[model samples]
Target: MRINKFIANSGFTSRRKADDLIIQGRVKINGQTIYEPGIQVVDGDKVEVEGKLLTIEKKFYIKLYKPVGFITSNFDPYNELDLNDLLDIDKRFFAAGRLDKDSEGLLIITNDGEFTNNLIHPKFKLDKEYIVKIDRKLRASQEKKFEKGLDIGNGEKTSDAKLEYLGNNTYSVIIHQGFNRQIRRMFKVLGARVIELKRIRIGKIFLGDLKEKEYKYFSKDELKFVDEMIR
Candidate 1:
């Protein structure tokens, strides 16, 4: 298997992260630093990342209905609530993407680096859906501007998005990119503030009626969709 794939299969991190480790001279093959990403490795060959021996582990696909006040983080120095604290799973799994500490909803957790890479990688254009409540109702002009794309400063602009009003000040939106605080920024530019934001969908996986802070193993059918999504 390729070095990056080997490291990812070992469940240490993502393939892209493995490549970074290789470039940084942190990855070694049989005691020699291996920087070539495509280099093949055999079952007998020793592989290490930062002096830690690489070993494969069972991969898991989990979905959690994250609630507000829990941050999607590996660690929190302040000892605040984190999504990992809510999980009762045995193995260490990382969130495919993230929801801010204030925001909440469906979160994907997995040990499959390739899947994470593909889902978040810019090339794949995976769809993410969010239900948002703004401080005020949005106008048709503002919705059109959002659909056309919003300039969120920093020389960055949002991609074309699909928007739907869900009554009152609430709305549903779908976007293909995972920009940081994107939904908030979009509404901010239109003179509104996002008071509540919750992700309900990623690709074909939906939150359905999953209660907050509860998680379930990904169904085989859902896993198949994830594979088909990246392909």
Candidate 2:
């Protein structure tokens, strides 16, 4: 198998991240540091990432209701709260998709690197649904502009989005792109500030009754749609 895939299969991280490690000379095969991501590995060849031996770990798929004030990462430089603290599982896992520190809602946690790549890759075009509360009511013209797309600075125009106006300055927004602070940036261009943002769904997976700081393993039925999509 390719070096990146081999590392990913070992449950260290996603293939993309593994490639980064290879390029950074952090990956070694039999004590030889390698800078090539495409190197092949065969049986009996030992691999080490960051000087730690790699081993295929049991895979886990979990859905978590991430609350505000927690970063969706394994480490934070400023010593802020991390989502991993809420999970009691002993296995190392990472978020498939991320929510900003101020945002809250559904998040997928897993140790399967291939699965993470497939779920977040733009080519799949998975629908991500969010509930956004802005500082003020949305105007008709602003809504039209938002639906058509806007230039959220740096000459980057957002794609067309679907929006449903719920009562009290809240709206249901659906987007496929996973740009950084995308929903918030889209609203900012229309003279609105997102007061609260919560993701409620990703494709067919719903947050449902999952409360903040709570998580559960994906049931067989829930995995059905996800598996079919990634495949």
Which candidate gets the maximum lDDT versus the true structure? 2
Model 1: lDDT of residue 206: 87
* Clashes by residue pair, model 1: none
TM-score of 2: 0.80
**Candidate 1 displacement at residue 219 in angstroms:** 0.4
Cα-based lDDT for every prediction = 0.87, 0.89
Quote the lDDT for 42 in model 1. Answer: 91
Per-residue lDDT of 72-99 in model 2, one digit per residue for the tens? 9987788889975788877777899889
Candidate 1 lDDT by residue in tens digits, 1-231: 899888988878877788899998899999999888999999799998999998888788888998998888767899999866889777777899988888989999987877887888878778899999999988899999999999998878999999999988999999988778889999999999999999999988888889988888889889897668435
Root-mean-square deviation per candidate: 2.5, 3.7
What C-alpha lDDT does candidate 1 achieve relative to the native structure? 0.87
Error of 2 at 174 (Å): 0.3
Query: Which predicted model would earn the best TM-score?
Result: 1
